[model samples]
Target: MLKIQEIRELIKLIDKSSINEFKYENDGAKIVLKKNGSGESQLAESHAQPAAVQSVPALQPQASVPVVQQQDAMPAAEQKEKVQDETLHKIVSPMVGTFYSASAPDQPAYVKAGDKVSKDSIVCIIEAMKLFNEIESEVNGEIVEVLAENGQLVEYGQPLFLVKSE
Candidate 1:
């Protein structure tokens, strides 16, 4: 069996690497790690034990039926909002971590909605594997929305903010 620290290290290494899946088994203990298309990692573990076998049933094929698709009409306001959203730039997380809106508990948040920022502006921080990384806004714009809350667990490529670029 792997220790908690060892598992954490393995997760960090796998997340940084290009490998999509890993499996290990030893002394009836098994561990599996997988990453999906969305860049999120999943961990699975099992301790093997003896079990009784049972009979299973087979499935029969069913006839196929034609499918129809319907689209709902959107309100004018919603359509306009969507169009504006499309024009906004999204600030996304580069790695999975805990999002921090400020440098410390007593400090003010780095940026808030309606705050104007430059391409080099530091917008927030993400803590991963005990390391705090400052995240920068890559676009010059006004922050239109803050998508992640303070101390929230964020995933890689997850949008953190929406900005209206200048």
Candidate 2:
């Protein structure tokens, strides 16, 4: 059986490569990994018959998801600006995990549509293996949309927020 660290390293490596799927088996041990919608990843392993399947979060760059800007907090009139263009920037998830709009459920969201932000602003948080990773914006602009819902399962490189470049 492979150690947890080895499995994690393999996952990181596979995420960077173009190979969509990978499978390996030897001496009664088996492992399988595959990419799903956009960049989400699924992994399965077994040591014997009737293998047990488990869900694993994807690992991808944070700026890869492409999406348009649309925010709920903006007025309808302001929301219509430059929406026809497909060049708006996006803040994407760095890893597969549960996405949270705020630090706590009851607290206000860290960012919403129509909010101005800098390249280093914190947009949201992603929780994986009991660790919370604060996702930051890589572009300076006005947040025009929030693509991922609060507490939603976000895949690697999935679009979390859309920003209209300044």
- Tens-place lDDT per residue, model 1, 1-166, is 7764466577779889999988978888777777665565666666666352111111111213423433247778888987888899999987768899999999999999999999989999998768999999999999999999999988666889999999
lDDT tens digits, residues 1-166, model 2?
6655576678778878997888878778787877765665567666665544334445432234544455787787666764643578978887768999999988999999999999898999999768999998998999989999998998766888888898
Candidate 2 — which residues are off by over 4 angstroms? 1-21, 26-29, 33-52, 57-85
Lowest-sum lDDT 10-residue window in model 1: 53-62
TM-scores of all candidate predictions against the true structure:
0.60, 0.65
Clashes of each: 0, 3
**What does candidate 2 score on TM?**
0.65
Candidate 1: where are CA atoms >4 Å away? 1-80
